[model samples]
Target: ANQEPIHVQIRQRKGRWIGHTLRKEPSNVTQQALDWNPQGKRKRGCPKQTWKQSILDKLRTTGLTWEAAKKHANDHKKD
Candidate 1:
């Protein structure tokens, strides 16, 4: 006997197309516990020293004031 094929739908959000079958599966207790890890414990390191120095170097080359360069770095950090 021929079996029926599963039906699936695709969804689009914010100009992104997502396949229906790619949906996240239900989480069990173990997965839930893993997801509940303390957010405060996460630590992200600063960007590479070479990259930061390059930005500073560029700012100096462009004749930007130290304060302006600092502000630029701060704004970039937000991204």
Candidate 2:
């Protein structure tokens, strides 16, 4: 951390996990969550945010693009 804000630390942590999950096989639950749609959806007030959205939101705080994050997922070491 070395004096980084708490939010910064959290975002960095989540971003790494998100990137990793996105690279998993489609059969993986983490990967499926990215595009999973519920059947017979109704009674929605505000649209529910998804795990993918939360991951992207965290990556936004780090200024990383979706493509970049995907590529980063393949990196052997974290940035």
Candidate 3:
């Protein structure tokens, strides 16, 4: 004996319903990434620190070691 085909329900723009056989499509990663909203909304502000390298340079000029500068940078990050 032969089996009947499966059907899927779809909605149309004008409040109409229709049924058709289901088909699979190839996945698109780029489109998927573009649609994703993991953060919910975009951040809107200037970054906390500008001229990171220049800040390090100034810290070095003040006799602070690179390790000390890095620590200071991390501390500033907490605020």
Candidate 4:
């Protein structure tokens, strides 16, 4: 079969969406939501990995920090 795996497709789409979000104004509601952090305590036990955390982890694996990734995303928008 010549099809991409579902996970691969999902990852590609997520990356595109994140890049689109990064290119938006900081005050944009969707962008704000991406950078938002809750200020409440969890019940207990192991803490869950947040969506932002997972995305950051993937960026780190590629040696890109949040700021760098944002810049890269914005730069690509010009092309």
Candidate 5:
């Protein structure tokens, strides 16, 4: 079958979803969710990596900050 690997497809979908969310108004619920921080206490130990942290780590590899990513996503020419 002519299709991308499942992981590749998932990555592409995530990128597109993030880009779409970034282009939304700052007050948008979905946009706000991206940077949301939990308020509850956690067990004392090393914390698990969060989705936001994971995304930030990936972006760091590409040398892009959150603001830069937002700008890039907003720039239709780069797509």
Candidate 6:
């Protein structure tokens, strides 16, 4: 329902999700995925970009620290 281009809309949505996840209570179900670290893994060569890393990268690209981004997301969610 937004007039924004697809890519812009996606970034906003993703940022919002990241923000929402961060704001959840520590014991929330969604928090587990964000905090999870696999017990055992040794892939060959270089490692892949992970979901957590991607979120951090996105925050960087948007010129936001995690806390700031979370606040922004929380504030905008009312709309």
Index of the highest-TM-score prediction: 4
TM-score for each candidate, following the candidate numbering: 0.25, 0.59, 0.24, 0.81, 0.78, 0.66
Task: Give the Cα-based TM-score of candidate 2 against the true structure.
Answer: 0.59
Number of the top lDDT candidate: 4
Candidate 4 — worst ten consecutive residues by lDDT sum? 43-52
Model 4 TM-score relative to the real fold: 0.81
Estimate every model's Cα lDDT from 0 to 1: 0.37, 0.74, 0.36, 0.85, 0.83, 0.75
Give the candidates in order of lDDT, highest first.
4, 5, 6, 2, 1, 3
Off by over 4 Å in 5: 43-48, 77-79
Cα-based lDDT at residue 77, candidate 2? 71
RMSD (Å) per prediction: 18.7, 3.6, 25.5, 2.0, 2.6, 3.2
Assess the local accuracy of residue 11 in candidate 6 as a C-alpha lDDT between 0 and 100. Answer: 83
Mind sharing the TM-score for model 1?
A: 0.25
Off by over 4 Å in 3: 1-50, 72-79
Off by over 4 Å in 2: 1-4, 39-45, 57-63, 77-79
Clashes of each: 0, 0, 0, 0, 0, 0
Worst 10 residues of 2 by lDDT: 37-46
Predict model 6's lDDT versus the native: 0.75
Candidate 3 lDDT over residue span 1-79, tens digit each: 4644332121121111101100111255532432344534445784334333443465576787646644443444222
Sorted by TM-score (best first), the order is 4, 5, 6, 2, 1, 3
Which 10 residues in a row give candidate 1 its minimum summed lDDT? 14-23
lDDT of 1: 0.37
For model 6, how does the per-residue alpha-carbon lDDT over 1-79 read when each residue is reduced to its tens digit?
6488999889888866787787787799887787676565668885765687788897788687867866675576454
